[model samples]
Target: MPDYYISQISHTDKTVIQGVTALLNAEGIRLDANLDYTCGMYDDEMNIIATGSCFGNTLRCLAVSSEHQGEGLMNQIISHLIEVQFERGNTHLFLYTKCSSAKFFGDLGFYEIARIDEQIVFMENRRTGFKNYLKKLEESSALQLQTLTKDTSANTATLQSDNALPDTSTADRKIAALVMNANPFTLGHQYLVEKAARENDLLHLFIVSEDASLVPFKVRKQLVMEGTAHLDNICYHDSGPYIISNATFPSYFQKDENAVIESHAMLDLTVFTEIAQTLGINRRYVGEEPTSLVTGIYNNIMSEKLPENGIECIIVPRKTDGKKAISASTVRQAIKDNDVDTLKKLVPESTLRYFESKEAKEVIERIRNSGNVIHY
Candidate 1:
């Protein structure tokens, strides 16, 4: 029989400490108890066959003896540790493991946050209720991955459209539509794209690249691509990490509209217009969603600035599902509640599967147990 328990290390547990030390040394993970940590293990007839530890807020050390491997013991221990961390208010959980372990935790909602010295993979899991922010991170990561593996075929489509642009000789005729932190690429975004594509022969879809959110930008961009793959006329490109996000548009988070307008709205308009001009883009497309105060400012700015810069502003109306406006928040709520029926109504089946595969149920369960009142 196997027994599992989690406990803090004390001076008396020298045998347990030595066993954990041996495992950590073998795995090349440094064990430091002074840091916030916990150890989980399975004891079978006085022998410790499996052991793992949570190192501070950043690292998860796990190892199992060869004899007891493949029994799914590691997963149970890891899940337990994660729950403990959540209870302790550790929102960001990190782990450094060999590349071989990638698929294991990836399935459990941990994603590669960074690569250390090209050897160890750093992974992290972000706590929920910051779903929008996490979605932004996923979009940015997808953009980076896409950039590293640039698809020439994807670029060819843009070039073909560029060739058809009116007065190609004029440098300002080509304009790209930018979407900074477009979390899930909602139908409103699709409406914006459609409006832009109708006006411009080539619509450059600039997905923001940043890690300010939990989903990892790469996954978010993939969702966008999958959602918009049928649109051959638009070109998908990353805005890189510097140009878009809260860092660039700090006013987006402000409670007051004027502060957001003065800071974020104006800054984004100026930045996009400058970049568009540099790239021979002469127009931009924006969706009219006044639900967000920041978005309302963006709409106002585009209406005012684009005309002055001789850039066309195309504002598409808010896409709605019956009376309610389609938003990422709504989809996230549906996911948290395990309302798959409502999710299907909100997103495409592919997107629905993406959320399902992310173990959104686990995320929702975490939310419910966190004792935080979730409005959705």
Candidate 2:
């Protein structure tokens, strides 16, 4: 065994960065565009042997030279990246690796959350991370079921007075789910939720909790809750780094035009199967995507893959305001332009009033300062 050293690869240092890129390319891996830090493992001759990078809490673009296989260099690279994530206050970590490399990562204490077409495996540091997430989801489902049963009992008593015995058992309930980013909770989002809520026995609404969007997660969740307060059969859940998050779907946040949309969507829906099983979700609702190539591709993949997993993927036509389909992008553009009338037509009153209030001043400024508000 020869002595090897690991060190951070400064983004400004093109010479060392090129070496890292060449190494990753040689390993048939593209250097991810969203990395905040990259590090390389060098041999005694200062030649790059292994490399790994980090973006948020995710470890990505990892590779070990073919010639250096079984040299334990990858372990060193992973350990270094874990230390970096810990220093950045990211306790729970995640990574995406090829199916061939997943076993290696699993041996290093990572657990698989899902795999996409048997090509990419999404893994995390904690063993019970995904299990605990499923447990929490099941608990939420039980609580919602208990509430429904109680309501049904009261309704049953009323029906008994009328001499009509109706089936109020939850066994026949049609559970559905909808996943949304809802950057600012536009009317289109509300329309989708409303329709799903109307048709389903219980609708589990999972909001993307990542803060990578122009609108922060807290504000997005708050607006969604306020906008849909009229809906009674909704179990609101924060998608915590599990569903369509940076860990599961980095392309959603990075906005990489060249991203493999199908691959990302498959991984997300693969994990979504577990969530569906936990909550008895038999269907998923998504607004039809006519614009936004990335989301369009994602929806296409989802429509194809989810059905294969026993979950019906419903693509509801986008709600139109007598013109074009109302989109979050349009709402964001209206906000950027301060078009009050367009805002009134695009979002619910709660969302509109929030943007008008002082609390939304910061978020509005953030959106306005963002040069590009439309995602096409």
Candidate 3:
């Protein structure tokens, strides 16, 4: 019954930002660092009672004052954020909310995608968004299988040999997957893909499609495909919004140090279970990342969680170029320093060629202008 109004909270307005941060803190929430837009609801007395934020298509760091509980202020905030998102052309919206608060958002038309026990819940506006994603994966897998079968038959017929084709039977076939950012598609990536392709009947390669890295997603994907073109067992899949990349993961969503890391890994792996099932994936391969704390934590979480879902998680040791282990971050640093020799040692020829092309001129400039390129 109390009068209330919502307004956009400018990041530059330190006074109002402090008020919003105080309210969120009182509610045991932290201000998310990755937000592009934020808004706060004010009562008649100009007190900040509720707040919400938008990062890309995600609604994050939402909170309401304890005194305003059940006053329908959050509904107003959500509506305001939705309108803002619509204006921004982000129709398919996503959000992260506490598990206990999920039902309230559900009533507002957000469907749950995945959760990490009682810590956090990942939701989206569309009811069938995740289902449709899985269906697309299944369809893509089937199409690729058909093409591979045809190619195998043609090769066998041309050779006129009884043993030209390998066993394509489902019983003995090994289907595995690898999800990679492939920011530059280094030789290390090629090494992992080569090993996986050699050992598996089919490899579902999911390229992180989020454009958050120094190298854009389009270039990353092109380099990945071009670098692995020799491998015949690969079925490439754009991660879309389903697969969470480092860029898309909201690291600042949770206040607890370990919970932040665990929540991200758990939510991602939970969604991946369904994807793995759809593609008949029994194993996942990841390159060893011994330096980055976030990635180390994620790999550990994957090792524990994937096995519970009957999927094996394999961490392949990083491939070395005689001196140091090859990494995208290292290659990025090389690009920044214009170290052509280091670049040659780290990335595949296809990836190296891409960076040297006229098409990569802007991207090279972008990388060179960046302050830091190393992941750690």
Candidate number of the best TM-score? 3
The number of clashing residue pairs in each candidate reads: 19, 0, 0
What would the TM-scores of all predictions be? 0.51, 0.90, 0.95
lDDT of 2 by residue, 1-376 (tens): 8888889889889999899989887887777767899998888889999999998889988889999999888888899999999999998999888888899999998999998655788899999999999998888767865665565576656433222223436476677899998988998999999899877767899999987898999999999999988766788899988886533354422224545676777778888999998877899998897776777888888888888888999999999999899988889999999999999999999998899999999999999999899876
Q: Tell me the spans in candidate 1 whose CA falls farther than 4 Å from its real position.
A: 1-174, 251-257, 358-376
Model 1's TM-score against the true structure:
0.51
RMSD of model 2 against the true structure: 3.6
* Candidate 3: regions farther than 4 A off: 157-168
Clashing pairs in 2: none
User: Which candidate would rank higher by lDDT, 1 or 2?
Assistant: 2
All candidates' lDDT scores? 0.59, 0.83, 0.87
The superposed Cα distance between candidate 1 and the true structure at residue 344, in angstroms, equals: 0.9
Query: Taking the tens digit of each residue's C-alpha lDDT, what string does model 1 give over 1-376?
Result: 4555555555357787777767656555445433345564646455555566554454455777666677777777787778778888876766656667777878878876443232345466753323434355346534643542353344545544432333334544555565745555566566566666666655677877764443457866887788767654556766653244543332212335475355445545555655555455676776667677657776787788788987777777778888877776666566557687877877765576777685545544543454432222
User: lDDT score of model 1?
Assistant: 0.59
